[model samples]
Target: MRAIVLTEPQAVALVNDWPDPEPGPGDVVVAIRAVGLCGSDLSVYDGDRAVPSLPWVMGHEGGGEIVATGPGVVDRHVGQRVVIEPNYCCFDCVACRNGRTSACDRRRIVGMNDPGLLAERVAVPARFTWPVPATVSDGALGCTEPLAVARTAVRRSGVAPGDRCLVVGAGSQGLFTCQTLLAAGAQVSVTEPHEGRLELAEQLGAKRVETAEVEPFPLVFDTAGVPAAWDTSLRAVAGGGTVVMIGMSRSPVSVSTRELVQRQVTIVGSLIYDHPTDFSATAAAVADGSVTPEQVLQAGSHPENAAAAFAKAREAPGKSWIDLSSWREESA
Candidate 1:
């Protein structure tokens, strides 16, 4: 098996002859099909994320075909297409018991804490596998993880009909947030400096696109971790409106507390999604034509072009698709 290993901070390599995973009881092995590159993965590569794990395969958003199943797994069989949940939680935890597994104190995110699916094959618990609809493409299915994050934010926002929503940043998660808000019937706007992503936001259903030239929004969600985004977000919030901070900023963000206090604005910080099945919901939405993941992502990238994909993502133009089939071709 071949895999992308992030051996340590700031180091990544494609390793060949990696031993293929063997399924344990109630576990399953999936043949990787497509993986979506996310900002969190970039944070892991850049060492901004402090969850200490090394020599790990770094991908949480992936979809694949079941190659084998372990004992006690009878509902799904070999050759079934599935999407990985990528969330590991201690069911005994208080948060888990409350159905907020994303907030479980003992949660270990695959690719973040455990070995990830950015490989030829990935082993995971059968409970974490969601059946992928035949109507869904592999690339779109792979994005279920991130879409779950956006979904969670939308779920938390308590968005009412006809409310205005603003998403700050046009990154992967930010664009998804915009789409979800629009789906909820909010008048959505997006703030992104990157022209390409701003165009994509418009394509994704944003009513207004704000660049350096545009004015501040009334309801704001900061999906870009930059302090500037936060600064703008605080100013953009309409009185009694909400601001959801969804991005990861390494440093402390300075905001005017007085402004928030004066406006009676609500500020909420959304972590990741809590329910493993949230990924399934995202997949269902994709399959049913509510969410189009392919429109948000560009074409797939081969191994030779893999570095370029990472570079392009870092440059902030568009999200990249890692085609596992490309690895097979490269090896051949």
Candidate 2:
């Protein structure tokens, strides 16, 4: 089996003799069809974030079809197209019991700490995989994971129909966040340095600003994941408002305790997303045309050039995607 392995920091290798994945109980072996690179994947690659070990597989956002099922799996079947949730939580954990599975005591992200799907196939827990409509393309399905992240940020903000909101970046995450906020009936505005992204933000129904210098809004979303973006979000949010952090920046930033306390600001740290329900909502939104995740996709690369695909991810204006359908069960 061919797999793209992150052999070390800032380096990746294509190994044609990589070991094949085997499905365990309650798991399914999926013949991967597509993958989307995320900022967090770059963080792991740059050694800005630490996983359990090295030589790790390097993609998270993905979709494909079931090729084989393990024991105790009853719902999914071979040949069913689906989107991979990537994150799975232990049901018996305290967080799961309290309906906060994203914070479960025992949770693992498939492509970060564990083995990833940047390969010909992946064996993922059946509970973390969701079936998609037959009409959904593999590229569109691969965009589900990040879109789910955006949806989670909006849902966490608790914005009402008329609430004014500001998103601090116009990247893919920022655009998706803006679109999700609009779908929730909130008035949305965006701040970005890139002219092209700001235009795309406007096309997606968001007001544009050169920076976060205008009037403060009741809710602010920070997708830039940088210290400056965090500071700007803090300043752009109205007193007693909420600022949701949606990016995966590892650097530390200074904060004003007095300002934070005086204004009664509520800061939230949102990660990937919750299981079942969050993905369920995202898939539904994509299906009904309430959200268009595919709009953020860039040109895709085939498996033969997967290493080059990752090399170009950091520079892609939109979501960097890889088409892995060549390795589908039928093709394999």
Candidate 3:
């Protein structure tokens, strides 16, 4: 089997003889069709974030057909097309017990913690797979993981129809969040300095703002995880309103707790999606034509164009995918 390996920082290579994954009980071997690139992928490639180990197969957002199924996996079988949920949660954890599986104390995100699915075929737990209908578009498939994240944020927001909502940043996450907000019946407004992204936001039926509104919003989503964006989010959300913090930023922001204390503003930190529900919500929206995530993603990049894909992924960033079909065919 062949796989894309990151041997070192800023170095990714295709290895032709990587060993095939052996499915254990409750697992299935997926004939990987595509792998979505993430911002974290760029950070790891640039040596900004640390990986658990080197020579890693780096992809958490991908899906394909099931070629094999392990024992106890009765609900799923061969030839089933599914997307990987990536987050492996410990159901016994405090968070999981409280209905917050996304924050499970012991959760491993594949491609970041475990080996990823950037190969011709990879073994994954059958429970983490979500089946997609043949009607779902490729664009939707390209952003399953991200849409799940967006879905979680919306689920956390407790948003109501006709409520005013603002999403800071028009990146892939921001755009998806914007669309999800709309699908949830919130009047969405997007803030981004990038003209192109703002344009895209308007196309998604969101009002594009030149800046983050200083006025209060019932729910505000901050997808841009920078210190400045944090400050703006705190300032923009009104008293008694909720701020859904969706950015995975490590940088610290110095802000007063006056708004939180005096105004009763709530800040909710969101990681990835909760198991089962989030993916199902997102996939349903895609299936119903309520949202189109692949609008931000480009065409598939073959293994032969891995170099070009990396460069393109870096250029546009976080909107690229490695097409595993070619290699899967070769193996066949």
Name the candidate that leads on TM-score. 2
TM-score of 3: 0.93
Q: What is the alpha-carbon lDDT for the whole of candidate 1?
A: 0.79
Per-residue lDDT over 1-332 for candidate 3, one digit per residue giving the tens place of the 0 to 100 score: 88998889878899988888999999999988888887777777777878888888888888888899998899998887787888899899898988789888789878887888888888999999888876765446668888889888888888889999989888778888887888888999878777777877888889976563457788889998888788778878888988899977778888677747898889999888777788777767777777778767767788777756765574462367877867666766
**Model 2 segments more than 4 A misplaced:** 52-54, 329-332
Runs of candidate 1 with Cα error greater than 4 angstroms are 50-54, 209-218, 326-332
Best by lDDT: 2
Candidate 2 per-residue C-alpha lDDT over 1-332 given as tens digits, one digit per residue, 9 for 90 to 100: 88888888878787888888889999999888898887888877777777777678888899888889999999999988888888888888888888788898688887777888888888999988888777888888778888999999888888899899999988878888988888899999999888877888898889987562568888999999899898788889899999999975668988889989999999999987777799888888776676777777777787777767777777556777888777674465
lDDT of 1 by residue, 1-332 (tens): 78887777767678887788999999998888888888878888777775455667887888778888999999889888888888888899888999888889888788787887789888999988888766678788667788888988888888876887788898888888888888888888888888888899998888555555445545678899788888778878778888888997767887677866888889888888877567667867876888776767777786545556665676665567688865533543
Clashing residue pairs found in predicted model 1: 102-274
Query: What's the CA error at residue 73 for candidate 3, in Å?
Result: 1.9
Instruction: Please identify model 3 stretches exceeding 4 Å from their true place.
Output: 212-214, 311-318
In model 3, state the lDDT of residue 112: 81
Q: What TM value does model 2 have?
A: 0.94
After best superposition, candidate 2 residue 321: deviation in angstroms?
Answer: 1.3
- TM-score winner between 1 and 3, please give it: 3
User: Residue 46 of model 2: what lDDT?
Assistant: 78
